[model samples]
Target: MQLTPTLLAEATRRGLLSTEQGQALWDFLAEQEREQQHDTPSFKAAHILYYLGGLIAIGAMTLFMTIGWEQFGGTGLLLISLVYGTAALLLTEYLFERKHLALPAGLTAVLAVVMVPLAVYGAQHAIGLWSDGDARHTAYRDFHYYIDWRWLVMEFATLAAGAVALWRYRLPFLVLPVAVTLWYMSMDLTPLLLGGDNLGFFSDLGKLISLWFGVAMTLLAFWVDLRSRHTKDFAFWLYIFGVLTFWGALSSMDSGSEWGKLAYCAINLLMIAIGAALSRRVFAVFGGLGIAGYLGHLSYTVFKDSLMFPLALTAIGLAVVAIGIYWQRHEAAIGRSLRRILPAPMRELVEQRRG
Candidate 1:
């Protein structure tokens, strides 16, 4: 009757067993496990039914999206998907105790994807992607002249809805959509400060503000993770890295001198290195992106006038890979250390099994 330290911690977290109830729960669970070694016919039948129901539900949703929903208006489709997804999630939570089913997350992610494309199409339509008469007679021309505040209101409403959903579900997948909405909002406000005539300044300011906000959010997420110890949500760290890299790219683009370029490259490399040293997965993934970017810069330089092999790229790649491997090994050691720190009840369970 062995209880792993991880299992004990999980039990404590779930309030399944208090300090006094730990030993009794362990004994009961062990006995239950022993008695359940031989599965009953009904148990097997129930499992089969559960899986079959999940499959059928997924298939039906897929068919509805492809056949019935695609023909609807963009707004209508989004609303339908939202309602159906919410209903499905509620039903699953009520029927089964599975709180974190993938279907709802999948549905929301798909809806976000659909929103982006539809929003882009709507923008194109308003901007006169296809206008037969005078260019001034196009939808784009009319849209700007008669710019409705309702469009801005709708965007803000959508952003608020997304924020609420993310907060309710605690899903990290919602971060991108939330960030996108924030960026759009920032862009909408840029004209107020930078002036509509200074398009370049407005664009630059918008990007800078968005990147700064992203960095701020990333730092906040890390702070939350530190308090909670939920390293599984690695996406927040990745988002931070992405925003920093983008900021670096923008800085490099604006740099005019050779030394300025070199400084930008050095700063970007330093940030990536620091980030990689902190997280092995991020290091492994973003190290590749950093290498590709450096190589592209090197290629551009070579084509312009300078002909030189990029030894720095090779060295940087090797360094990143080496650090990633070290972190992986270090993480394993940490796991072993944690196992040795098991509480008394869990340690007792382990001893019982050994006896």
Candidate 2:
């Protein structure tokens, strides 16, 4: 009838008791079970103090932020508070690395809140609301435009920094979102450059550079995940979705005649095929989009000119036949080449699946 070690361990894991407290409780219960005594207290006060301390700490920090100490030092107090909060959050993370405390998430949230007020204040100081007579009005306008350029630069810098930081911190989860954000910003700037608005062709060039960087970042993310022993998680799926959406949108925006469109479509298809061959999830997602897009185009073509439908069908049939013949002749050589290029583990997987 004595309490078992397994029960004691389960209680600790469930947080009903700390390990030390659980051990003591188990010993007491075992003694009582042996002696037929039932006088011992069933609960301990230590657990209550542990939770109470956490609640007090949270409440104290909340009160400190809510109380208006701004009158004493104005902006200085706010800045000091921000710095102190950031430092404390970082320190807590460093001290409690094993707890999964989500300190990074909290720090990001707090920084965002601090930035909101700073952004509004800077905007107001730069430009008066709806008043042209204010000298600051012109200055604000300039500031606004300046901000656009500043943002472009900052976004690029952030993209690079995020890549390096991801590698340094070994947090592949962050790289894709940051890359996507930078890509989005670059896309927004693309129209301005295309319209000859004088952000310069350099801006267009920068956008193209960002586009390629985004592609590289995405591939790197996949490669890292594939090589990693960790389970594929939310971040991996997010990158796949983002890459597909971004690339699909880009393909739709491409302007060209039938031949040009055909070429673009072929390139997209090749990209997908390569992705599938590599077994990269992001590539597979994009490949699916390419397939959908191709089918949609074929449907549009057939509906627009029913007579062309037969010719299109014949062309597709011939293409498929030709590809099948080529694959039959070259599949072995291609497989060997791929195995040489891939890592040892991945190469073995590829070899095992060769058709």
Candidate 3:
């Protein structure tokens, strides 16, 4: 469905548009796409450096915090965070206004939002609201690795700050922090929801929550993609975290029965199908890994002594590859046939893209 130079030239020849008009339209759109490519963070060297340097600075401020950093009184830490956040915000303003760099501006703004959790932590510590018993002695890195209900305050504050930054900037890069905060919240909220009463129960419940939150995030990503067709990818972060949480939670489940394992495999395959439909490779990746894990388990446990199992699996893989080639060759015809087989309303749904 994409309009390319060839399509435009063909259209001009077919009298859909005058030659001049066709060329003009193509040129305009080509320029726009080029500009967007330059501005948006991607695999380009400049963009990579922008994000790498920004992440390094951000990591220094948060993730790489030393025990010595905690020696600074809570008030001092809070003041320092405030100073850093203010500087980041000022840079964001300068970039947006003078430099016209949306991606860099959003990254700068995320730096500010990134400081929120630390600032909130300091403020909480300054008051008598330090984290749970053992968490009080835990390093800042533990905030990421471990879930404590006390961390909810920091997560909420970070999410709010990220929301404000995104609202003010309208930049896609800002979604990273928000998506991350949501992921953290998804884990942290588990303890509170379950009242942190039983360790084993909490672990299982947290995984369930992670799976559902991922599902919700994935659905939301689809909604965003549908609404923002032909624009920069605003749903990329959502898709990433969604797939991570969903696949992580699903993979962690200890399926006892063969039926349970088969169901798990089926869900992963469904994820692959969904990925193909949506053109989101994250879904395919997670699904592929999940299926691989399942297959490995079967190989090591159920079929350890069965040489035929590996042969059968190899044959299945070859069949899939052959099917893929056939699909590639006649995708349009196959799609038409599938749609024709559907009810009228369903056919319309299949034929239509987001718009």
Best by lDDT: 3
lDDT of each: 0.49, 0.50, 0.82
Model 2: what TM-score?
0.46
- Tens digits of per-residue lDDT, candidate 3, 1-355, equal 7998899999999999999999899989999889878786679988998999889988888778776877776787799899999999999999999999887888899899999988988888777576345534455556876776768878888988888887788888888988988888888788788876343223877788888999999888877776555556788899999889888888887888989999999999999988776667898998898899889989998899998998999999999999999999999888777667766543443345423
Which regions of candidate 1 fall more than 4 Å away from where they truly are? 1-152, 186-188, 197-202, 230-252, 280-288, 299-355
Query: Clash totals for all models, in order?
Result: 0, 0, 0
- Candidate 3, clashing residue pairs? none
Residue range with the least summed lDDT across 10 consecutive positions in model 2? 138-147
Q: Which residue pairs clash within candidate 1?
A: none
Deviation from native of the Cα of residue 202 in model 3, angstroms: 7.2
Best of the two (2, 3) by lDDT: 3
Deviation from native of the Cα of residue 108 in model 2, angstroms: 6.3
lDDT of 1 by residue, 278-314 (tens): 4424434444465466557767774445443556656
Per-residue CA lDDT of candidate 2, range 212-238, in tens?
545765665556545552332224533
Candidate 2 — which pairs collide? none
All candidates in order of TM-score, best leading: 3, 1, 2
Q: Estimate each model's TM-score.
A: 0.49, 0.46, 0.87
Which whole-number lDDT from 0 to 100 does residue 210 have in model 2? 46
Candidate 1 has what TM-score? 0.49
* After superposition, candidate 2 runs with Cα above 4 Å error: 1-96, 100-147, 153-169, 184-249, 253-255, 307-355
